[model samples]
Target: MAQQERGKRSRRSILEAAARVFDERGYDAASTNEILARTGLTRGSLYHHFPSKQAIALALVEAHGEALRPPERPVRLQSVIDLTLEFARRLQSDPLLRASVRLTIEQSSFDCPPRTTYDQSFEAILALLQEADRHQEVLPGVDVQEAASTIVGSFTGLQTMSQAYSGRADLLERIGIFWKLLLPGIATPGLIGHLRTTLPDD
Candidate 1:
């Protein structure tokens, strides 16, 4: 049991280190040596856990996806707003998550299927939108699946632009703007008036 726990810790260390290197250099420019240097681990140890750099990048993408799971809320539409706000906060503060986003965008270079990340995110948002539609919180004519896709695509473009121009320093504010722009079309007037576009204070 102890040996297994140690292995898990070691694997986490490698992943964390790889995330940092990948975040800084991007996937193609990121080097295994840099990852190893960051982890302070021998090549054998890293290879024992991740067979290749591409595997590490894939794992990073999965980690970010897991981090994005929305917290449940009594009002489903509010939950959707909270989900985007929470992710925006993480994008500003979390290195692993930031790296994961980078890896996902650059997946083509790693020969990874880009849709894996998008599909996972789309399904999560789609489930929430479907629930909201059933609750009548969604606007009368909105298609839940289509709305979900728009939300995902919008955020992806917004975050990429934010990262490029501001290093995500303005991500939370950008998310608020995104929600403000998006809510009018998706939420009923009653829900739109009450939905929180910004996350609460830290």
Candidate 2:
């Protein structure tokens, strides 16, 4: 058990180091040597866990998908909103999440096809919207699938702008405004009234 736990920790360290390097240097410019240096792990150890940089990037994408799994909430639409807000918070601070976004964009250059990461995000949101539809929380005439796509697209654009302009310091605020603008058009009146645009503390 101890040996297995140690192996998990070592793999985690490698992935995290790789995320930081990728987030800083981008996929094309990031080097395995830099990842090794960041983890303080030997070449042999890294190869034992991840055979190639492509493998590391794929693993990071998988991790990002897992991170997007939001906690279940009674109000499904609220879950969707909360998930986006939480993602913005993590994008502001989590190197793994930030790196995942970069890897998804740069995967084509590295011969790693980027479909599962984004598809998973889309499917998750679609499922939430469908559930909200069943609950009558969605406004009349709102197409659940289309609404899901719009939410994801809007968040992605806003997040990219936040990254470019301020390193995401204003991300939560922008995300809040995003929800405020979107909810009125998609959510039922009662649901929209209860939904929060700002983070709870704000």
On lDDT, the leading prediction is 2
lDDT of 1 by residue, 103-198 (tens): 777744776556567788888899999999999998888888889999989999999999889988898888889889988998888777778888
Q: Write down the TM-score for model 2.
A: 0.94
Off by over 4 Å in 1: none
Collision pairs in model 1? none
What lDDT is obtained when candidate 1 is compared to the true structure? 0.86
* Clash pairs (backbone) in predicted model 2: none
Against the correct fold, how does model 1 do in TM-score?
A: 0.94
Clashes of 1: 0
lDDT of 2 by residue, 43-155 (tens): 99999999999999889888888767875888888899888888889898999999998887654466545576567789889988999899999988998888888888888
> Local error of candidate 2 at 187, Å?
0.9
lDDT of each: 0.86, 0.86
